[model samples]
Target chain A: MRASLKSFTPLILFLGLVVLLAFGLKTDPRKVPSPLVGKPAPRFSLPALQDPNRTVSNADLAGKLSLVNVWASWCVSCRAEHAELMRLSREEEDLQILGLNWKDDVVAATRMLRVYGDPYRVSAFDPDNQVGIHWGVYGAPETFVVDFEGTIRYKHIGPIDRTVWEQDLLPLIQAIRKTTNGHE
Target chain B: MNTNPAAPLVSVICEIFNRILIPIAPLRAILLTALLAVSTASAYTLEAFAFEDPAQAAAFRELIEELRCLVCQNESLAGSQAELAQDLREEVYRRFRAGEGRDEIVDFLVARYGDFVLYDPPLKPSTYLLWFGPFLLITVSTFFLIRTLLHKRQSPDSALSPREHEQLRELLDPHGSDRDGRNGPDQDKSDRER
Candidate 1:
């Protein structure tokens, strides 16, 4: 009886490991929580994608709720999320949506914008990805929600969909706006 | 052939040649092809970083390998061909060239990307399970194994009572031919005679 129980110990341990791994599998590895959440967003200045002579900086995003989306013309997910972003721009008139065009040819980025319809108030061209590095961007199709004080409140790491917009992002934006309006 | 003076030496040499070199020839060919395949596969263009100091360049290489690529979780920053990995490598090289210490550079990445960027996470409250979990399992298993062995050692001598021993003797000597009832000196002779 004792021998049988002793042999069963290994099976128990194996089952425990299986359960832990099963739980781990449910989590998306791509959605690792960013360290920049709740911290002030990084500052940067870059030439506008449409006009190289004109530039935009972090200062323009102050005193408003903003969405800073990191995207590239080559990123397929960016195209997938572009329509949602355009709809969001139309829906949220007060929300300032900015774009950081990461590591793409200027001509290609401009062409993509022309075809897809620009949703950003100002899309900053980041050919060298210097500003992207400062923003701690790992890849394209990442979005950050910055509060009125320019603090990054939330970060979405993949293509945004309607469900994500309604469930996670829109509620948070509304809450922040309510608090900011109360203070005013 | 047996009478030949050099027959034994020739046979020994043939045996050694057959045992060793015959098998190794094909294995060597396979290894050569594998090496060629690997070299050609990894010949894709990569961004290069120049450093004024060779030591700094070596440090940069080490640091990049130690950092994990967030986009490609399984690959190191140095090994990944992802664009983000390239940009990170560039960032590390830039920082190393700017006179940042290895710890400083790693800390900067950790601050921005969090501990996930590190292949080897630092020991802390949050990472205690990751760092010490294997050792904990080993220690627990060792404890149980030692306890089981100790219990087994004690059971044979102390756990068996006199009545149980008598029953065990009866079970072993089922024939019960001897009047002494125990397996004595006569029992061996009886078995040998049979």
Candidate 2:
């Protein structure tokens, strides 16, 4: 037993180190798990990006499955994710894409929307990022999947491509829908 | 003096110094002063947040210094120039001004950003590996180390027997066994003569 244990020690340590290093290499350091998941979405009322007279708030996200996409005109990833957002908006009629125009110039945000078809149901203008602070928004191109009851179910950091929408977001949305339907 | 190898080199170096270095000394000083001024101008300036007391200001500084900036992973909330870091600083300042203590402020940040915001992570089930993994590694390695050392100490191959010692001595000094055992003092004199 002692001889066997001695022989296995180097092999065990080598395998363990390989596993640890591979895991580290595969994982993205920037993708931090948000504590906001499973909690109610933070409340905020801000002026609409396009029409300053109109307002969008947490109340707007109520009684519907909403994808609160935190984006900005200055963010490159936001532009990258625009087509996906537009496609999602088109496909999922029930899914409301509530935009949080985080820390961006209003004119530029409006121009961006006009140029690349507006995917948002109603975009909230947050110039000073007061609402963003409450939402724990560190970077742009973050999307929060809020359930019908306004509880945040999932948060996707970085640009959302077609694969991400199908693989991660769709399954979660379907699961939430099934549960909600069963309860009702 | 002419025979000295470095004489020509030294005179040439002196000539170059007189022709170049002395003329550029004032210019180098001016250039150095400009560089110093640029560095001083670009030094970090803390955002002016009004505080009721000096104690509150110190606490606020300490709080931000501990909080990690999410945008720039390595920078603290106090040091990062990222807009998100600025927003976070403002949030901390707001909470501080409202008379909330350090724990409460940290808790609030953790609630939103998760434990990643804090420089010092709390002792929890999730963080057990992060906190104690190094010590556990040291302990395991030390156990193996001590075992190897003890094993080495007990190994018979390392210790020489009487016969092996004699053989080694003969091999090292070929004439020692043939020479007089009492005449060992004269061995060195014989060696010198040879």
Candidate 3:
């Protein structure tokens, strides 16, 4: 009996490892937690997408609740979320939506905005992706919710669908607004 | 089936051909193909960067491999063909050219993208499990294994009482013990007389 139990030890260890690996396999490795959450959003100044001569910066986004979306003309996922963004822009009057046009040609971005309907209050062109790097943008269509103090409150990695907007983002925004209004 | 002098030689040749050369032929082909694949796979174009010194260039290459491509997830910045990886490589290059050290560049990336941007995550409270979980499992397993081995070795020698030992002896040699018991004193007397 003792020998049998002793021999089963390896089998037990193997099973434990199998279980751990199975759990790991079920997880999506791309959904990495961002460090910028709860930290001050990186400051940047760039040429506006509409008019290259005009500039927009992070200073303009301060003292108001804002959603900064990083997107590019080449990104397919950005198109998927564009309609939702347009709807949100129309519905939510108090929330300011800013655009970081990541590594896109100005002409293409301008054309895309004109065709798709511009939801951004001001779209900043990041021709070299410098501002995108500062914002920790690895992929297009990443969105961040910034609070009144310019701190990044929440981040959404992929295309923001109706479910994600309703379940996660909407409640958080409401709660933040409540606290900020209470203080005021 | 031929009983000739040269038949054994012919059979030996056939055996060598069938058993050795036939099997090795496919294996050699596979090895050659694998070698070709590996050689072609490593044929990558050299990335152009103006470095102040060879050491800086080496550091730049090392840092690129150390950083993870967030978009690709599985590939390092050096190996990835993703646009984000290209941008990150450019960013690292620019930073290095501007006199930023390896640690400073890594810190800058970590600040923005978090430790996920690093291929090798630093040891901290949150990542302690990632770093040491396997060691912890090994230690626990080793403890249990040693305990079980020690118990198995010591149990037979120390666990039996004298009564239990007697019972075991009786069970093993019951007939031999009965004969010895009957002839014990007689055999001793006979041996003494001799």
Candidate 4:
């Protein structure tokens, strides 16, 4: 009984430590809840990267299908999902792609644009994240597809991969473009 | 066709009661559901509870936010609607409104409940790990973190200096002493420190 009692002590302590470690450690996702779904996209008029005079807002792209991709140069997932954005540009002529860059300096974002083949028609800068917060974004690399009427149709979190493009994103664009939303 | 004043009067009264009472019942039900939903949206209080005064009720709500619902170890009392959290919130409110000072309330809880009552406890030698473990763990992890990350470092010796590692380890085990390592002191120092 004494020997068995001695052997059981180590197992108990090991189990105890494992429980303590698991309970103590806390991980933060640093993500915001998706708020734009089933609502109108927040309106903004940001100057285009190259064409400083040309400002794009929610109103400018009304009555046309637009894809707004929220990304940052620092986001690893954005790098992972860049190729798919390029693919979307190739396949869909009517689906205009816009980049809403969050918290990224011009130089780094410009570098990312160069590397990723600039699928964005125009990239907007969100320094100090005021625009991002107004849009209610936590971390970057989120995507929203707005219909011609300025109502948001879909939100894609993380990267725009092949499966999502086929399953959800493509179907939404095909349906929204059919709506009577043509702005000359 | 013979007109009857008595029959017409009875029918008019029936119609009047239906118009008033039937609509009001549905309206009351709708209002009741709306109130429940709004209350449920902040459902971290867990249980149906009440305080003696408005002040105790408000403070209890804040205190619950700080406490970890034991059932949902990751969630605070304010963030969880678990039954245990509900019961705990009620307990906290009961004590707070009863004119107990903060320390007395907490001590009574600690005496019966153990160290899980407070979200952040005092930093004694015994609870040093609990209070400072996050920072220490982050620091030690930072060193190993830097090493794993900086395999591209200029010098191998620059893989977090020994002093840095010791400090990191000390931080990780906030309640640790030289005599006993890792978890709060073993039997020898547990008595002395705790």
Candidate 5:
């Protein structure tokens, strides 16, 4: 037993080291939940693509139902998503679709607008992509639906489709609109 | 008009020769410095997929980090984060791009470096114990701990020595079986008490 106790201490410590290593390996970053919900819209300003003198700011979005779609010409999926944006702008009432062209060249973004026909109220060019990073725009063509009350209500990470609009988008707008009217 | 180019050349050569000699360690250091400078400018070329899709990039990261580097031992390609591990990860991505299945990738790795690469070694005849080693270790340890404790409680040799017995006797009685062997009067009393 005397000899056993001497060896057992090291053995127990070695086992502990194994457990520590297992815990260490599991310690990578987990998914982050978005904090944008219930908070006021993040203030931003960008140069309008078509008209350089006319800039769009968060203040411009006051008292309206609007969507801020982050897109770029270089992004392949943005081409696939052109028509849906036009359809939303055409069909929806009091729903303004604004474009945020992130990390794009002026010429390319302009060409994209010309090719696809601009669906936005006015597209803004964010050359340095600072705004995209702030919005957690990890990819091109992400959409955020901002309410008239200046709160970002919804986020779409990829291309928005009919299924997403029918299932997620339309319901969200109706609910927010209904709740706000009750206050009146 | 007394200008010989060789005369000036000889003086310059002498100055250079004076500065050129060094201890062996310093010479070795100079050589190593030159080697490092050469390598600094050497460009290493490699190809890796730059995914525009964040989902794909996330998936790629998961696969690279989780998968063990076959060429290296006992290191996850992600955790080691070595150049060889990076190369292996790039290879895995290439295979992923080619639409190779997971089994095909694993097979490729196992072919290159056998079971030593795997952290969770498979349970076959050869590695049956390796796969089950931890549980077996815990079981053996538990058995030994209980056995050691029980042995201490029950073993006859674990009892107090003769010297301890004498000390106990002295403690129990002030005059313990001494002085003219008359039992010290209290000796029998003490024994009876014990």
Candidate 6:
């Protein structure tokens, strides 16, 4: 029995290595877990994208479950996610979708919103990317789920389609809503 | 040597180097220009933030060097030109100008971007494997290797037994004395013919 176990040692080690490597290969290296989750959302005050005269801030998102989406007109994936956002806006009345227009030309951003459809309840224009840096936004189309208390509940990197909305975001939102209602 | 398939190609290369390449003034000038361009390009200036105190400037330089650029994973904040990297550099500069200490600034970035923002990851429970994995592997491999060597040393002797030795002697020298009269392997054919 001792010899048999000894003989299988190499095979066992190889299998362990294979499993570890397979898991690593399946994971996306670009998706770094945000430390901002479970913490209060970063403070920011920027002019609204549609109306430059009006300002939007985190205070506006208070007392509502918010979806803060980091997007740019130049980002192709955001364009892909735009229709979904519109659909989500129409569907979920309680869920506030706040757009963060990051490091983009104002004219182009406005044009894209006009051409497609503006899904955001209020879009904050971050032309200098000062607010984006504070929010730890590395790429475009990153979505953050903020609870009614303005605490970031979850951060989803990459574009959100229907599958992502259903599989990941929807469940998390439901869970947060349940807990918040229970507390209330 | 002349029949070698690669001989002609080698000779052509040698001929080109001796004649066209070595004597070409414009080619040399172009190569010199390229070298100068690379050297000048490599000399980067951190002119965006200027501090009155040289120590503060040095600190700023050191801090950015230690910070990792998220967009380009392998590059330091000082070297990266990606939009996010630029924004991060500006943020670091802003923090320095605000009179925040290096540790405070690092903590601020770590809070936002996680520990990935720092080139040197902190010693923590999650990073224990990363910090000590090499030493553990070395210790394990050394233990196994020593055990193998000691086990090999303790193995039974491989010398032939007395009975086997006797059998080998008999096979080599069947006839104990005057073995010349015996039919040798090559001489067996001659003996058969006779």
Best by TM-score: 6
Pairs of residues clashing in candidate 2: none
lDDT of 3 by residue, A1-184 (tens): 9989979988998999899899999987877778899999888999899988888997878898999999889999999999999999999988999999988988899999999899999999898888888888878889999999899999998898899899989999999999999999
lDDT tens digits by residue: candidate 2, A39-143 = 999989999998899989988988999999999999999999999999999999889999999999988999999998999999999999889988989899999
B1-194: candidate 6 lDDT, tens digit per residue:
47899999999999998899788978889999999999777555698689999999999999999999988989999998777888888888988999999999999899999999899999999999999999999999999999999988999568899999977886888563235466666567766889
Interface RMSD of each: 1.0, 0.7, 0.9, 17.0, 17.4, 0.7
DockQ score for candidate 3: 0.59
Q: Give the clashing residue pairs of candidate 1, or none.
A: none
Docking class of 3: medium
True contacts preserved, each candidate? Answer: 0.63, 0.77, 0.90, 0.00, 0.00, 0.70
- 4 or 5, which is superior by lDDT? 5
Q: Please provide, for model 6 over A1-184, each residue's C-alpha lDDT reduced to its tens digit, 9 standing for 90 to 100.
A: 9999999999999999999999999998889899999999999999999899998998887999999999999999999999999999999988989999999999999999999999999899998988988898999999999999999989999999999999999999999889989998
Question: What's model 4's lDDT at A168?
Answer: 77
| DockQ metric, candidate 6 | 0.63
Record all residue pairs in model 5 with backbone atoms less than 3 Å apart, i.e. clashing. none
Candidate 5: regions farther than 4 A off:
A1-33, B1-194
Residues B1-194, candidate 2, lDDT per residue (tens digit)?
A: 49999999999999999999999999999999999999877554674777868888888998899999998999999998777888888888888888899999999899999999999999999999999999999999999899989988888466788999987887798676565464565766897899
lDDT of each: 0.88, 0.91, 0.88, 0.71, 0.73, 0.91
Where does the lowest 10-residue lDDT sum fall in candidate 5 chain A?
Answer: A28-37
Q: What tens-digit string does per-residue lDDT give for candidate 5 at B19-127? A: 6653455888989999998876443322245777677667666665556653344568666544446556666777877777666876655543344445556778987
Return the candidate ranking by TM-score, descending.
6, 2, 3, 1, 5, 4
Error of 5 at A94 (Å): 0.9
Minimal lDDT window, size 10, model 5 chain B: B40-49
**Residue-wise C-alpha lDDT for candidate 4, range B36-114, written one tens digit per residue:** 9998785653345676567766766676777665456678767766644555555566677677766776665554334
For candidate 5, the TM-score is: 0.43
Query: Can you tell me which runs of candidate 3 are displaced by over 4 Å?
Result: A1-23, B1-47, B154-194
Clash counts for the predictions, in order: 0, 0, 0, 6, 0, 0
Provide the lDDT at A74 for model 2.
94
TM-score winner between candidates 1 and 6: 6
